[model samples]
Target: MSRGHRLALAILLLTAATAPVGTAPVTANAGDGALVTAVPNPTADGDAGEYAVVRVPTASTANWTLDDGERVVAVPTDRPAARVALTATPNATRRLTDVPVVAVPALALSNAGERLRLRRNGAAAAALTYRDAPEGDRLVRTDDGTAWRPLGYQPRDVHRYGPATVTGFVLPDSPSLPVETLRSARRRLLLAGYTLTSSRVVDALIAAHRRGVAVRVLVDAEPVGGRTARGAAALDRLAAAGVDVRALGGPRARFDYHHPKYAVVDDRALVLTENWKPAGVGGRSSRGWGVVVDSAPVAADLAALFRADAGWRDALPWRRFRRGKTFAPGASAEGSYPSRFEPTETTAAGVRVLTAPGNAESALVGVIDGADDRVDVIQPTVGRRDGPLLRATIRAAERGVRVRILVSGAWYVAEENAALVEWLNGLAERRDLPLTARVAEPAGRYEKIHAKGVVADGVVVVGSLNWNENAVSENREVALAVRSDALAAYFRETFVADWQGRGRVGRTTWVVVAGALAALVLAVVVARKTIRFA
Candidate 1:
């Protein structure tokens, strides 16, 4: 708000107002599908209530005027120039591939509950009315109808994306997974996670909103039932606080459930292998790993996914949950699981992002297959006895690599994981493989290892991708594979600490204990029979 900066912004605004208007390729008017595609309420350079994006459809004329209820806002004339004072991005391809975009520089369309109209030849063609628009959101109309999607995040597809500087960090340590991390958001906050039940986290977000940060959140609709009811209740609390919240998965949802967990604050992308619930990372109730990426491209990539899911208005629909006390229906997927999002390639210098219901399994197997020396893993759930991930670990052990797996020993996670460990140990004994498995004990600061991460050779794969069939092929998940020793070693040290802690019990010791209990029971039964005979 300095004088010099204000003067520069004013100059830019004047340029946009007098800039030559460019002609469109067609003669279609507002009555056609010539609707607005993007309205960047506040451009990166300009303040709010100063700019907007107007989409002039293909085969349409650019000679049109926009109105803000009572008066005219913009009138176009013949001058060969781009429509917008700033460059705008397309929400999609196909019909909107090459649509001419006009960046209106002087429209005061930032206030909520204001009606903005596009008119041609004195006839109103299209209109947009917003209510509590989230911070940094763009109003878009991709189809012919008037339903505009509030796209809060920007899109940067894979091909157009660039390198990312991936930095590794351990959560509940060093920086610790505290609410203060979110409370520090300055400009925009984009959050997409599996579940959010932590009150401190929610309160921090509310505080951020009060401080004028544009905050938006997307969470899985399931878990509204069962033991995870608090997560749904927290969503209600967030909505009541005026935070723009959206639930993924309802009647017309895409996948079985949405399960990706990450957050973008300004240019930083914080990816995690835990949910936003209390037990996941709050106070280190469970062991988890997180990565902080200081790359704009990486942040933009995640922001794009958020935008797609939040703004999905197509036939394969994504429904928004209403703010209420009653639980929303269609939150659960029952037993039917399906694929929704498409997979794309992500390769940077030392990091790669793999999304599930795609090639995440392949990427995971590829990491294990490429291991040359050792493999260390901490997972809450393992796949089937002979699944791809398990088989890869077995193969790694077969090749004389030191393979160690630390699985959850908490009651709920122990049943499924214990059976897998017993089977794997039996197989390892028979095949003389170097694989060793242990179940984490629930006696320390952390009760369970809810993370899905591995240190194979020098590469680290960490995120919300659980080692299960459903996680890889049914639920929507995300993970980061960093092929750097420094990053991998950070996780490796944490793994080593957990391995040596009293919280982990080896497989061989469990077998011996089970045998001793059986012997004790038989001896007691024999003594009772002798006493009865006497």
Candidate 2:
């Protein structure tokens, strides 16, 4: 009777759909000008866990100050958005609503110079344009210099993805660029109703500010602060360089907002990846690819969720986000990658194939309910309690879904979630279920295989969050779902190599976990054989 785990599913659904769980609401940094507001969550630093709306405000007449006492003024207010550059205070644990701690997401959006025009019903709904947009609420017009465009959107009711399903996404880029990803996320948001933001993003704003890229970031109204908010620093830097920085308003949350990691670059490319901070490109992050899709419906959906220039005057800011005539669409070169992503209109309902942090929970049900053939899961950690997610996996296997899981191999750490590893295996044997499990041994450098993805027939989910329930409900997490095989195969191959204990050697790519010890032994054996032969 592997039914829908009705009680568990219902409880999970109810919990996710439930509004905030009685946390105090505080507005710390309330300011004027064009502001992007995001419901700030508890700082991941394990401090006093406070939540507020980040009121980052930027305008021509604005002067900015950050938590680190960093100040920037008279900066150029034209170009891409930038984070205020501020130094983190030493061991500062008290959460500050107006502490002016901006954020920097993990991976900034990718820009390929190529642009696209997104239209609905013949009239242009949004355009994939980029350029020097000022730090105020405005639009960047087309080359013809005719009409204006508005980049900001109003805030709406926010919902978590689902129980254990992070009803959220990640927006990790600079203010203006990050704004683009927020805009892109709007659609999924409108349809699904969730919140999203990122870390590496705040860094982008800082970089943009330093480079004289006119910057302004609008975060959720809630002002949540962490130890080091690179976004705030970027905002400070941009203000110092004469760029106006601003923030808006949001509802205060009792708990922290942890799941957000997506980026939109110059409103050109929308990037979905898991590399945050050291986890992104040019860092020690695991093997991950950033997919930059061309779509405006995506951007518009995100923009709709933000409280658009609501705090500032309705003046044209620059050449891109300004409310104006649509730019000509770019060439529609076929995407070499695979995508079965159906347009919103064509997608079917009741498949209940929702995507989000909560997906971790849904993955089990997603497979149990729909996986008629197989279910393959890969997570660095799978804890006990037979979480709704794990239970779903076991149930699917029991029902003949060929539930197979590949847990990451902690080549170095002794208790590297090995307990959970043994537990997953036990789950299979205890139930005598036809489930298969494997440990992906490390292939190289002190790098423990950290790819968290799952494959259920045609559905694929990928991101940085672990499979553990803690990640589902606690940590800041983000993941993307793809119904394409091409993408799945790529992920599968990488997983296989790690499990086979074969590091595809390249330059000093990454350090192998204690597997390095194995290399040492191999070298010794070869040396001994040569001496004996000689």
Full-model lDDT, candidate 2: 0.37
TM-scores of the models, in the order given:
0.60, 0.44
Error of 1 at 384 (Å): 0.9
TM-score for candidate 1, please give it: 0.60
> Which ranges in model 1 have alpha carbons more than 4 Å from their true place?
1-167, 174-178, 224-233, 313-320, 323-349, 502-534
- The candidate scoring highest on lDDT is 1
* Per-model lDDT: 0.61, 0.37
Prediction 2 TM-score vs. true: 0.44
lDDT tens per residue, model 2, 16-112: 1112422212222333211122111122332222211122334433443211112211222232333231112312212332234433222121121
Off by over 4 Å in 2: 1-251, 266-275, 305-360, 409-416, 473-478, 502-534
The alpha-carbon deviation from the true structure for residue 217 of candidate 2, after best TM-score superposition, in angstroms, is 5.3
Local accuracy of candidate 1 as per-residue lDDT tens digits, 96-181: 22334344444444434455555666565555454443333344322222222223222222122345666565544422443555
Worst window of 10 by summed lDDT in candidate 1? 10-19
